[model samples]
Target chain A: MIKPWLRIALAGNANVGKSVIFNQLTSLNQIVGNWPGKTVERAEGTLFFKGYTIRIIDLPGIYSLSTFSMDEIVSRDYIAVEKPDIIINVVDASALERNLYFTLQLLELGASIVIDLNQIDFAAKKGIRIDVEKLSEALGVPVVPTVAITGSGINELLSTVITVTSGERKLKPLKVRYGKEIEKRVQAIEKLISTKLPQLCTVYPARWVAIKLLERDTDVAGKLKNYKNGKEILDYAEKLATELEKIHGEPSPVVIASERYGLANKIAKEVTAIEAPPRISLEQKLDAITTHKILGYPILTVAVVSMFALIFVGGNFLSAGLEFLFENLSMFIEWGLSTFLPRIVVDLINNGILAGVVAGITIALPYIVPFYIILALLEDSGYLPRAAFLMDNLMHKIGLHGKAFIPLMLGYGCSVPAALAAG
Target chain B: MQSGSRGSSKRRNPRGIKGVISLISLREGEKGVMAYAVGGFGLVRRLAEMGLTPSVEVKLLRKGPFHGPVQIEVRGVGLALGYDVASKVFVRPLKAKLDD
Candidate 1:
């Protein structure tokens, strides 16, 4: 059977194993960084599955579809504009309420999606039990429980994806409705958009554009600027927003956000039950010490010092080992070539091209590989946030947040991911 | 006590309801319910997107030393907010009634 190429974007909150799932599905060497916003840009990989080619896009972790951050804008534009065939809404099951907040926003955009309920093991450990069938019914989307790191439930996730894409499984997504007050204005703006700006409606769901207008999203507002009667719609949106502000006594955006959170909280409460009392795990205990007011700084100092020291000692050892191997290989190659070619030619080939390649591998890979491994370990173990929590105030002295330390430390190993992190 | 700290009335209790204080004012381990953020629309939306919307329970899990960011737990998620950002998110502390 012939199948057309399908594009699926994996999106959710930061550090919720989207990249891990991306790696699982596409077998791509995506940096599975632990920190939020680690995947600054969208990473794409293709998988040939059961005769169908699927394009998987791993979007940066975002809390909401709001245009406050670069990651949000990139992910939002890609989903709304590019219109991927299926969006894998990867929710961290451990933090269902918070993760669902983003999931709700994606639903509002009217994109076809399946909830990759990633990190179910973590939730179970935390004593949180989710009714998967109920959650799927509530959201009106297929919910697949997955442990991306262990490659569990990944095959089921793919089969479900193919079924949904093939139209074998029909989805009736529940529309995200807000409070009556907000809903009234949303309908008014949505009608105005559909009738006046039909072209914009094609690009974005009319209702989504209307809701964004109600939130006074500058990005959505900017998109409307190109169309005729755009100014009139903006004025109408602004006027309605002011009226909403009057009733809520807060900004329009906040009011809309509160409503979205309200919905997310409701769904989370409905589908999740506490099966067991949460026990303080070793991870929490470690977090306590590493982020302790007094002890944290000392631990951080030792961690930082030891990381660099290991890199130095390990890199040197590996470098020497590789250099020795290359030296022997170079001698063998030169001897074999000199028997046939001129001595000068053999020397040039051995000393120039081969030597350059060997030197790069021996010097760079030895240091870079160790640095990345240690960095990944620090991130994967969830120690980086604790380190950031400790350094927050001191980092303020330099006019950067404590989170800035991650990129600064990353700069030592390589400047590229560090620069991306900083951005 | 409130008189000395009074500045922009708009930034003050946005709803004119008393007994709310900045989230940063809570000591480590203290709990509060989110009230409202006082900064621009961007900050309020950003905080809410992180699940810090009004009426949600929050606990100050840790405070960085030397006037740094405050780590707060909301909706079972831990978030570190810089001093400037945390100060704008006013919350009604659970201890306020006891103190009063």
Candidate 2:
């Protein structure tokens, strides 16, 4: 008898086209549901290969598994507890240095991973040359080049996934070593947490939790509040933090982040190659005007006004055409009703519900669809971040930080999702 | 009272015209003469930092919206303040030509 389905996870940063790759792998065969406890959406799809069904899960986009954000917490929980058979880390080739920061954190989780170097086409056009073989060897994971949007190298990626999932390909672990003091503190905290909360064993690494506690992460402390002797555990952790801070002359989070960055830089230097600096291209010029300190706001205002103007002009014309079509359709429907039914029934069918519903759909389509399309385009183009940066000072004065500006700007498009995002 | 300081002139306007400096001018710390408030609770910290205590002298340059949301040049910088807060800031308007 064939074994059960092998579970695979697709993880990456936002805008890395993880969704596109997920769609490609499992075209129409997918299920969307919330994860067991969290409200975050989870998607699962099946791919049958070599007589075994593989279950693929698309996890939320997270910058790191360090648990600073809610998304990271959810992602870390899933990977640590669920223990998926393989993790396909889809990394953007153009921004490999930043992407590798998360890659190193994921490696420390000690899970099996395959790195998907996505957006090769765009990277190449920008003159970015990647050494995939060297990167794979350095990271100790199979690195596959892919243009997920165009479906290039996806087959190879799938085959590699299959191979890794099947245990035919073994990956050597990437060990990240911190300073002696941190390692010692990590070991102490890991022992305490493991002994105190064995039930949480599947959910979080004791060492990771210890590091977060040492950093004075309130979120983690709150989460572990129910554990036996939680207050004592926290006190001990705080004592350790005080000692470490005295030695390091900085907060624990800063020290740990510095160490992570140092490791990432070292690995990046070994695995990646940077060519001579390229000349400023068209995109850079556009970025300059678009993100200019002085010119950016005016340009943004004009662009927004132009978009509204187009929407108004196009909407009027489209509404007239839609009215004509709907009028003709209404006439056809009336004729059909009159011919097929008695007078009373025909009158009821024509006047009661169908007419109102059709009119509603017609009215909603033009405004709702166009507005949604425009908002989606703005989000996909990554213009929202620039808008946030431009309006940061104004937002900062209003008691909301600059980071909150993105959701507020997006709120202009749709309040529901924007509020959700802000929350 | 004698005006003894160099290049100093003293003139008084109608009573009860004061405002807080919202922004410091681009220039180095020059004593702000007038200011305004832009709404939001966060400005409390900024006002504290800028030494904008009550009973400070302020002159209103421009008022917007229902004769409110006034913009006053304070410490060489322009500040827009709301009407509710501006009413509380009492000022003695400068009678001399302080613009130079």
Candidate 3:
């Protein structure tokens, strides 16, 4: 009997430890690069489990499926076109409401999903006890609580994936219900699309297409224009959207997004019991200070400067030791070659091969590896977002968000290391 | 720009959120429940995705001294909404009965 292949995608919001879970599952041989012409990075890796080869892709971290950003576009296209066997939404248990908002979108897409509730320990510390079974039942999917850093609940997540993919377990993901005003329009557009343009559903969920139409998502809206009856669908969508706007006293997308959040919040409140007031922890206090208006700038400057100083100082020391060791190694190789070969061969050994290897090992690797580690450490400790939060106003002035700061700074150094560190 | 939208009709006049006051009116550390994110669809979606839904309580964490962008805490996450974006959202003060 031949083993079948299973394709999985790790989807989540940023800082939910999606990358950590990806690293734990795939381990090595991961290919990392940008999504052709786009600056945002793409990561893919492969592994074998239970005699089945599994290909895992770490999609870009995005807050929503709306095409407001490149990350959202790339992720949605992949899910719609490629259609992976299972999508694992690695959510921060502590931030259920926000994380669940994204999960609600995935469910709307009708994806075969397994929820990996990462960072459950932190949530527990916050006096949040999530009833895993109840959450699973509510979302109508398997819910696996995991501390990705510790590799807990990973096996259960894997097994659940197999069951869901192999048809042993059936999943009926909960679909979010928008209020009557929006729902009525969704039904009308859904009917039009099905009757006139059924092929659209082949690419995207029919109702999802209607919702996107109502929300005036440019990417989806632009694509629909090319199809027959697309004009009618768009016009109807626009009219319905306008009515929705008037009814809610907001835009159509806002109404849709709020409805989604309403569902997420309701679900979160139901499945989790807050045993204590989620008070500000020490980390939260420090996080606040790091982004404080009066003190944040100085702290940010000192933190970045200190980080680079440590990297330079530590890299210098490591490089010095490595340089000393490799120099002797190259000398020994040259001597060994000189005893048996001509001068030219010894020169080649000394200047050509040994030089290249020594330069890479003793110089580049020493600095790049440690610097990348420290940068990742800062990012993982949740400092980057805080720094971004503090510098948001400044970045906003430049027509960018605070999240752009890290990438902008990374460009000053080698772009490769920056991509490795940030991507 | 005035925080409230000119196009959309008000569903219900919020009692908690000042009737006409926008998010800019809130002081630091003042917490209130969101009434509406009044703006274009794109802008509203951006804020809603950050958990700034109607009736959801939020805290004004900080803002730069020079009338800069504001940082807010919503759904246990801290975010910095630009001045333009911040002003578009309206909020009512959190009431004791709506603590949940």
Candidate 4:
């Protein structure tokens, strides 16, 4: 009963409600796994709608498509190579301009895009009004204003996904105009690529390859160099980039970035208007005490200590319960076998493989489950950054940040199981 | 519109510290708008690509006395950056008005 499936990718910055939207769309139909040999988490889910079986892939949360991190490389490569039928760029309405920067980059790769203008509720509360239709027109993509937490606009987003991918709706993905000098060089490079390495043009947009080449993006360069004449194409791009840098008096990457931001800012201003901002709200008030210069560190200490205590106590409880349950089971087996079986057979079953299995279950699962719960809680509730902000100085003293400390603490907690294994 | 405003403001400042402060210099609870991220070409590009730009607002959530990495909130998201990188990121303290 397997039907042909259309693939959709939900791509967005962290805290922009991408996961919430994914949760709403998939709703317990997700398989949380990891990319092969990568520690980065991957989530895939399936949705059946209107006689079509669509598979949705939630790419890693990333701010940009640059190869500055593994997540970025994984995300961008998937979109480029896999060529998902549609890319739903989940944008934070409250942070429209910054989010749009990523959307624009997606467009450069020539993917069919549907802008999920998420968190409209937060934006409206902050007195930011967006003309959704106007933004859609500006970006040449269907922009759906959504409160993903409540499932608002989810249907519209889905329908748009269907229509756009099915080619029922024809739209032009907006291209960033990086002015004459830069565009000229890009064209020259694109021509070189299309002529010499025409096969690459099929995989990636010729102009994007040219642009990435000029910016010297490592991941793209790595891929390009493996091609038939990628080195010559890269050298040509390097020459053009140097020439542009000479004229601009700044690095080509910087020059390219300024243009992108400049365009994003301009587009944002055109479609947004402010109503009246609300009074100083709950998050700010909480931050005042939890992030205050005097009170922040104390609060940070208590939170971490309490988290450790809770995990230690909870893990110990689970550990003891499992140990007791397994001890009785193991003893019962040994007794049952000893009554009728040979002594050697009974001892081997009791002390060898059974012991190893019993040791693993009792020792590992308890600590691992609780530690993950605390980690996910901190990560999801938006407290890790605050903790990092609070502990930056203290952490820096030990050559780590608050982010690095969390995993290190998890490792230390695992020592509990290691201790049990030793016994 | 943004470029015009920046030009007018720059003309009046001359030598005034119009909006130039390192990311690390920001105190707790103070928010500013990112203006320029200066460093080697690679660093500037990476920072910009990561959403540190002229328009986004950044708030210092926590920091240490000196030579400590700075934690900041930008566009309602948190990020921790080292002292060296933070020092190179120049942000302008938000004025009485909300720019966004």
Candidate 5:
């Protein structure tokens, strides 16, 4: 008997090791594609573990469910509409408060979530200690602390997923409850949505829809406008939001965002304790010099020059080695196959396909490999952002922002990924 | 386009205007409490979602060398805001030393 495929999604903020976890679970079994009609890349991979085939989708990393960008909209729609069986929320343990702000939104969306507290070691180094059990209890979901790079706690995470999805263990995620002012309006809109447009409830939780409407989310508003009663609900939502604006003296979206942040801050404080006041670490020291007003420019120049210099030298050595090895292999193949096959066939097999492949690898792989490894190192080590910070002023003069420098720099190595990243 | 010195020097009556200065005006190591961000709904909402709500304390960690982005600490998170965006986020300095 074949077990049904278990669907899981890895969701999180940018740079929280979600991709690392995705790569860990899926290993070589992965396919990269685009989300239909959207330029956003979608990665799907499968893992077979413990008599189960699990399909994992890595959603685009985004900060909130708000439709600020195409990524946020795609993630939110996938969670609410597609409805994955389990969502592995990879949150940075070092930055729990800000990360939890996104978690709160996920909970609000009513997704079945397991919090992957990634980079726990980084948090520990910063003298931050988290009560994992307390956090699990607070969120009312299983919390797995993991260091994705080292593969620690990954097995336990899988086991937890099995236990939760297999019906042995149950998840009772905590519902986010806003303050009195916002909660009352949320309930009012939720009630109106349930009564007026019950069909919308089938696709989304009434409460979630109500909250989105209150936030003046254009996506939901557009969807609502299609329904006959949606106009009435939209008007009511606008009036209620205006009332909230009157009370808060800010836009409804800002009001709701502030309230959500307040709750995230509260939960983060409750579950985490700082063992020591922040002392300057080596990263901080490096950050200081690398981003210094006067020294930063010269250092950035040196760093860029050294990177290219290393890549060129390393690629040349590797290409020469591979070329030598492949030359002998091609000769052997030609000689070995000539005895059994025609000269033309041997030539086709050896010189045509094999030589072509060998040439491509020797020419392309050597350079691409070193360039990517160095790029990954720069990104993972958090130096790339600083480099961008240092180049911001210079980059702005060329009609671009600081972040534009990354793809521009990537252009020196390869135009394909650089163009994709620039988009 | 007000520089730090120029912005601070143009003193307004404390009772009338209250000393809420643009976030970029705070030099490195200076601390301020976030007032409200002034921008279109998109910008304000985006900043608020990143935990830059009113009353949260922010410290100017560093500024890009030449009128670039401003790196600030808000709610225990460090965020880099562009010059134009940073200028819209008004904050009240914790200490009133600009006058002295």
Candidate 6:
């Protein structure tokens, strides 16, 4: 009998090399498509492990599961609705604290997870140390350290996945405690939602949805509006918020975030060990000059201009080289065609379609490729945010703020993808 | 209630006239009729966060082409605000000080 397929999800923040890890796991066999009705791209691949085919889906990178942004909404919706068997939460080892914020939110979603501590080599080189065993024990999930770029720990990661999927390893869910009033509100709303929205009860934990509703989350509130008891739930949440404000003197959302961060700080201190303060590394020195108030804008302009200048000069040289090669190939093809085909047919193949296609490819590669490479380098080096910060005042004058700069910087690669991202 | 200033008060209304972009063009340090704050992260929000909220004293430093982005000094910070966002921000231009 064929074994049942197990679904796994790889999720993390942007620029954590999740794609690199996905490529390593899937090798040459991967399928890319859009999520239903959304512009976000979805990648699915399969691995044959331990006599069973395990299918892995790479979801979009998101900062938080709070439905503030569209990507966050899509990611949260997928995990809450689809209920994948396991979620591989890939985190950047160097920036564990910020990454752990998302991890805590993921835990709240109630999905089984395996934390993949990626970029261990870089972390070690920078004098950062993490105790994987202790981390796994604390989070109640298997923690695998990986250097996806160099293929380190990949096999062991795969083995861990197999072991966990096959029931060889068991992980208990980690629960976070919100304060007394919030807990009471969560329980009350969960009871009402469970009874009213029976169909969705199995999809997402009612308590999670209830917590979001009490935070005045428009997305969750809108989703629950069709239910018969939606109004009753809203009224109960408002009353609870009023009572809590009287006692606590703050809003529910702020209180919940503070609790989550407090828990994250505790977990971070327990699992990870630091030798000393982060040194003023090369990146910091570069940032000091590039983001400096006096010379910053001039340096940024020079860098951008020089990058474009290099692309233009290199394109001319490459185009000349390719032209010589293509000319010789055309001559060879012409001689062979003359021996077997008519003159008009030969002309059509050589000059009509083939020449035009070759010209298009040549133009696209030398010019477009270098520009894209520079943009990617800037993005990977983490200078784009600094650039946005410097240009914030200028952007505001144009009726947009610095946040819009993120999408504009992305547009350098492809406008279509940038538009989707901006949405 | 000085005798000479009493007649000037009738001619110059304390609540400045609600003129359009013309009022925004006036130099800073001039007294204004009323200043209103635009809420949220709109053009007004960005300017306000930078200490250029409506009703605050403003001086037009430079105006770009054809009612384009205008540079103004507000609370010691120089800012360039777009024409559209600036137009949305309502202000009553204050009268020029006697020393000026």
Best by TM-score: 5
Mind sharing the TM-score for model 2? Answer: 0.71
Per-model i-RMS: 1.2, 15.1, 2.7, 3.0, 0.9, 11.6
For model 5, the local distance difference test gives: 0.88
Worst 10 residues of 1 chain B by lDDT: B1-10
Poorest 10 consecutive residues by lDDT, candidate 2 chain A:
A362-371
**Decreasing TM-score order of the candidates:** 5, 1, 3, 4, 6, 2
Evaluation by DockQ, superior candidate among 2 and 5: 5
Candidates sorted on DockQ, descending: 5, 1, 3, 4, 6, 2
TM-score, predicted candidate 5 vs. hidden true structure: 0.87
RMSD of each: 4.8, 12.7, 5.2, 6.3, 4.3, 11.4
- lDDT (CA) for every model shown? 0.86, 0.67, 0.83, 0.80, 0.88, 0.70
lDDT by residue (tens digit), candidate 4, A1-423? 554679999999887989999999999999999977787889999999887898999999887888878898889888998999999999999888778888889999888899999999999998899999999999999999899989999999999988887789987878778889989998999899999998988889999899999887878889888887988998889999999989976678877876787788788888999889677898878856775667777887887788788888997899899889988988999989999999899888888878898888778777777777877798877777766666666776787755666765555667653343233
The C-alpha local distance difference test score for the whole of candidate 1 amounts to: 0.86
lDDT of 1 by residue, B18-91 (tens): 88877766777889998888777677778877888888899988767776677899988888888778878888
How do all models score by TM-score? 0.85, 0.71, 0.81, 0.80, 0.87, 0.71
| Model 3: colliding residue pairs | B17-B92
Writing each residue's lDDT as its tens digit, candidate 6 over B1-100 gives 2212312443232235435233344543443332543334333323433444334556665443344455565532345565555544545665677754
* Clash count, one per candidate: 0, 8, 1, 0, 0, 7
User: Residue-wise lDDT of candidate 5 within A1-423, one digit each (tens)?
Assistant: 888899999999998999999999999899999999999999999999999999999999988889999999999999999999999999999999999999998999999889999999999998899999999999999999999999998999998998888888888888999989999999999999999999989989999999999999999999999999999999999999999999998889999998888889889999999998768888899999988889988988887888878777898999999999999999998889998999999989887999999988998788778877887888878888888898887898998867687678768876755676687
True contacts kept of each: 0.86, 0.00, 0.61, 0.39, 0.80, 0.00
Q: Which regions of candidate 3 deviate over 4 angstroms?
A: A34-40, A278-280, A293-377, A384-423, B1-18, B38-40, B64-69, B95-100
Q: Clash pairs of candidate 6?
A: B16-B33, B28-B58, B28-B59, B31-B94, B31-B95, B32-B94, B35-B55
> Mind giving the per-residue lDDT tens digits that candidate 1 earns over A1-423?
578999889999888998789999988634433224444655778888888888888888888898887888888888998999999999999999999888889999998999999999989999999999999999999999999999999999999999999999989998999999999999999999899989888889999999999999999999899988899999999999999999988888888888888888899999999987877788889888988879988999899889878876898999999999999999999888989999889978899988999988987788778877887898878898778877877887899877788778768866755676687
Question: Candidate 2, after superposition: displacement of residue B32 in Å?
Answer: 32
lDDT of 2 at A292: 62
Looking at model 3 chain A, report the run of 10 residues with the lowest lDDT sum. Answer: A414-423
Per-residue lDDT over A276-388 for candidate 3, one digit per residue giving the tens place of the 0 to 100 score: 78777898799678878779889988987787777668879999999999888888887787889999988887998889988888777877887778767887788987787
Which TM-score does chain B of candidate 1 obtain?
0.79
